[model samples]
Target chain A: MEKAGIPVVQITAVTPVARMVGSNRVIQGHGIVHPLGDADLPPEEEKELRRQLVQQALEALKREVKS
Target chain B: MRVVHYLNQFFGGVGGEEKAGTSLEVHSGALGPGRVLEQALGEGFQVVQTLVCGDNYAVENMDELSVRVLEMVRSAKADLFVAGPCFNAGRYGVAAGALCAAVQAELGIPAVTAMVPENPGVDLYRQELYIVDSGSNVAAMRDVVARMAHISLKLVRQEPIGRPSEEGYISRGILRDELVERTAAARMADMVLAKANEEPFESELPVTVFPPVPAPPPVRDMSRAIIAVVTDGGLVPLGNPDHIPLSAATIWGSYSVAGIDNLEGGNYEVAHRGYDTRHVLEDPNRLVPLDVLRELERAGVIGKLYEEFLSTSGLGNPLGNSRRLGREMAQKLKGVVDAVILTST
Candidate 1:
């Protein structure tokens, strides 16, 4: 989508793959299967973790990236 | 010369789409297109047998089918194996290419097949088989079969194959030492002069060049910018309503998230097969943070969240297919979304 002139932030557990595929901005994800939340944590804590990841993604969107 | 021809059920005169589940079967003498192929092979070459299988069955059970087909070809004591001029049939092309590759590798027989370059089979087996680039036109079957026969002859006689353009096969990307008239310095100088004069010149080493994509400007205002979420995590509605493939997917779907605060496990499912989906199955929110996004939307941390989320399975996805999916999603979000969060697995 970067070619379409829209900023895109990729969240992935495998950062190298994201970079290889030429993702502009990447945020380290939690794991391969569960990128946002950890199921082992209690529901409330998992929600909190998910919230933090979303917040990080929001921050990534706002940050400027090199061309 | 003895030849074994492979064909799909339709070409073998069994039936149409309804017979796509037909298992592998062998028949003596040329069947349907095999006769055309046999005639093209000339007076000496004879099509000893024709093997037919359903496109669906061949693809679904490729491993077992290829093995059994190999055994049959071995017993036939065939001098050469020729599979479809599959044209544009993806499944048939895959089956033909796969079977030919196996026959050539295992039995040490010269094998040939035909398909369009865009067929997924081309990418998988081009290097292993001399796949004739049969343009996607079934009406040109005679011409395509002729080309397949020509290549099969050269392969069987152990003749050096010509350039892809001359031989009408897809380039296998395999380089070989070729005797040229010009020395390295002379060739380099000539190429430089041609390039400097703005004349047409072909580089000896062709390189794949990708177009540069400039990064889009960052979102300036966090409080009043629209954001959308996209995922390659293969999150889909229950029962996989869209029927997207588990791998090598060619389609994407947008599911309505309106009025939905959280993704309950039972309401959604993971359609990708590359990773262990148990974690995502336990909690769909683990893949898509809809609950948190909704909370943030309510808190007014952002202006608004897109009502629908776009999803596609990325496992074994090819560049051509994935690029289209991305461009389509981008076009849909063009003026509506100020930024996007694409989660990948």
Candidate 2:
């Protein structure tokens, strides 16, 4: 889909499968049940954690230049 | 040369689809199509025995049945193996192709089979076995058997099989090495120069397929680009006013967190039917991190969030549906959203 001019980043628990399937950019997640959150972490901690991950996604969107 | 032949129940004349669960039974002589095939083999090779099994039973028990079939063929000590010109019968074609491939691998025998080009078997076994072109159904049986017999004889004698078009067989995507007057570098140069001159030239190599999607050029500035978050996580407001199905959902609803700082638990729910939604219902953030995206927005890390988020639940999705949905969603965001983060569960 990215080849058509849209930039796409995938966040997945199955990082290997994402890589293998040729997902352009991928961010690893903790578990299949909840991709972006740690149920055990406090709200602030979870927010900070997700912030870093989202930040990666944002940076990934900007720098991935392969056509 | 001795040859072992394979057949499914109906082709073996044991019974119709009703007997598709029948056990493996070996007959000492040609049965049904094999009789004609044996005749076509002429005096040089003989159809020593016919191996029969149910199509349903063969595919359903592929590993066990293939091992058994190999044992039966091995004991025959056949120089070659032949299976059905199963025509358009899907199950029977699969059985014929599979058994032929197994025979070649297990007994080290030259094996050949025939089936319609559209047969699933052609795709699976064409590379391993020289699959002669056959008719869609039994009406082309005689012509098919003749071609198969001719190919089998060539294989039995260890003669080189020609290209798929020349030999009347489906391409297994095999590249045959042949002596050519043109050198490799010369041929490549000719191809390039001809194309540059707007002349037609056939590619020497098969098309390179399944190339990975290249990543697009990265965003030059994050603080000024509109980033959108999309999910297959099935996010929805508390009541799920859009009624996106809990599973296999194609309906994605965009609720306003536009003004909200963080998604409060109980205000949102995960409508996905794939996983236990217990944890997600307590906090939808687990599936889609709107809370964190909101934080990013406040910190000016991103220019702006595309006001409406996109989502659907596809924990178990067909490839066709996934592709279609992707196109549809992408179309919606084409000119509006600058970048996408697609979250998959």
Candidate 3:
């Protein structure tokens, strides 16, 4: 997708793996199974976590990427 | 020994690009490079038949053509099958590899084909056939043919085949159980010693190095940018409406989130088997975060969310498959989506 001129923010718990695979914008997620929402958290808190992660992804989109 | 050869239009003495649409044709004896191949295979081996097809037609109708080619090979009673020293010809390499694999599998004939390492067919069919590395130079046809014939002879005789480097073939990634003088630990120590001494050493295991992808420029205006959420987390509608596989998926689906605000648990399910999907099953938002994205969309944090979520399963996914799908998704999202939030498990 990056090669197609669209910046992509990959949300995964395995940030290093993402970077190694050439994902430019990577945001650390909560876990492997549930990248956005945490299962252990209460529903409201989980939503908050997801919100924060999404916001971070947006922030990642706004920034410049250095090689 | 009766050997059958496959060739593309140009090599088959047919006109070049103009003849690329010509269908399959069978001819007697060796034609063009097949004579070289027959000679390489030695006096006992005769090129009994040659199958020629246009590269475009062969690739465009690979499945049907393969079936027909297999039937022809079966009837020909060929002892060995040889397809091009195709080198870097993409379509020809694919057709050759496919036919070689089919003949070997169906007719119980030893089959050999050759291609350059970068030919797409090398990656697609190297595991199934002995693809001699022809090194992208048509001038080296005799060398490539000799290697292919050598490997084919060994295969026909049920001999233990040599490694890719020794045989001049692309690696099939099959590990052989060999009795060596050095233990793994010893080899590892030697490799470490070599590295420490700034000397060159070949590692036993070859790592697949992905070509670096240049980062696309960041979205200029966040408030007006249209964003799409895509996932390899395998979230799908209940019953897997698009039938996305649980692992090594070849298909992706775009589920309509047009009027929907948040993804409901019962209406959606996880199609991936790589992880414990119980959390995602209970609340699909855990995987895709549609709820949070919806909130952001409404709050004008972004211009809009792409109405559909692009999804595919990533379990046991190969890099080739992922790259193909990513390119397809990129093509689909080119004009509309400004950025993407790709969730992976």
Candidate 4:
């Protein structure tokens, strides 16, 4: 995409697989169910899970190429 | 002398199938079925407080129950927490398991529970806490409570409790040291001899070391680099979802977003079965947040992000999958991107 003038980022609850498949940019999440949190659980838990995942995603974007 | 006892609704004398809907409550005395614990502990150990919460209440309200139980134990001055001989009741077993885990975590006190091997709770909580194997029915109450109390006493007194094998409890994932009768030199010699002769030998010593794998060759330059973003979280389309089987996903697919700003609804979703796909499907951004990466690319932080995103299901996927995926992805991205950033949840 970059060669064609497009920017891309990939987000997933599981970043290991993303890295394995070779995404340009990647993000991590909390769990399999409710990468954020399920509605059955309290709202606070969901928010915290989402916040952590978002923080990790932003950090992935900031990472400089070290190759 | 201070101890806490945990019991399900039936054991707490809250009535059988008739009163299964009973609410959780903490009592100070030997209420309901606590008499068994009281008698087993004898005079030295006292059941200072009894926590009689229903099985459904604890599992359904884990956060609140954890908080409330922690507070109760803190005020009760408990030196140890003992849970139920849950028999075959699955929910009751899980509740006891959760309570024991919470008590150990919050109070830093030793906790013990008894459950039948077939109980689902045994599998989930055994690794987290000590769960002694018990009979499948309530007929084993006397033996179960007595054994649990004996172990609880040893824990409270800081005594050297025997190994899980000898003490008849499930293994707690703790590597316990056992002093065998054989000398170290003799054991090593026997092991080497057995290995040479192709005979079974008991090893008294274990070596803890892992050889490191060679590192990948460094990329030449960043100015003209090809970057690829790979995900194993099974993100795909909802309609004809690209289902990546859990633990054994051999194939991976790439989705094209040539001119799109962000992955919109019906455009991308997760195909991984190991994790729930609702959140990521509801907001595809959760699985692939192109907004932030686009900004980075525009700022020249990276030369250019890869055109396609590689994806597969990662849950329980063996190491072979990792090797295959890494090699395949690396081959595709090597000429295009300077570096790759691998992410796992």
Top of the candidates by lDDT: 3
Quote the lDDT for B3 in model 1: 97
- Compose the digit string of candidate 2's lDDT tens values, residues B1-345: 888899989989889989999988899978888889989998866778998898888889988988988888888888988888788888888888888888888788888888887776875677677888887767778888998888888887789877777778877776666799989999999999999999988786755234466677777778877888788888888788888887766666666657876667778777787876676777777777777777677788888888877877876664445656777788788878778988877
Kindly list the per-residue Cα lDDT of model 1 for residues B28-130, writing each as its tens digit.
Answer: 9898888889888888899999999999999999999989999999999999999998988889999999999999999999999999987878867887889
How many residue pairs clash in each candidate at the backbone level? 0, 8, 0, 39
TM-score ranking, high to low: 3, 1, 2, 4
True contacts kept of each: 0.92, 0.78, 0.93, 0.11
Interface C-alpha root-mean-square deviation of candidate 3: 0.8
Which consecutive 10 residues in model 2 chain B have the weakest lDDT in total?
A: B205-214
Instruction: Evaluate model 3: give its TM-score.
Output: 0.80
* Predictions in order: lDDT: 0.89, 0.79, 0.89, 0.66
Model 2 / residue B284 / CA error / Å? 17
- TM-scores of the candidates, chain A only: 0.92, 0.84, 0.94, 0.59
Q: Candidate 4, B12: how far from true, in Å? A: 0.9
Better of 1 and 4 by TM-score: 1
DockQ score of the complex predicted as candidate 1: 0.54
Error of 4 at B97 (Å): 1.0
* Residue pairs with clashing backbones, model 2: A61-B219, A62-B218, A62-B219, A63-B218, A64-B216, A64-B217, A64-B218, A65-B217
Query: B306, model 4: CA deviation in Å?
Result: 26
Candidate 1's TM-score on the B chain: 0.61
TM-score of chain B of each: 0.61, 0.56, 0.82, 0.56
Q: Ten residues in a row with the worst lDDT in model 3 chain B?
A: B208-217
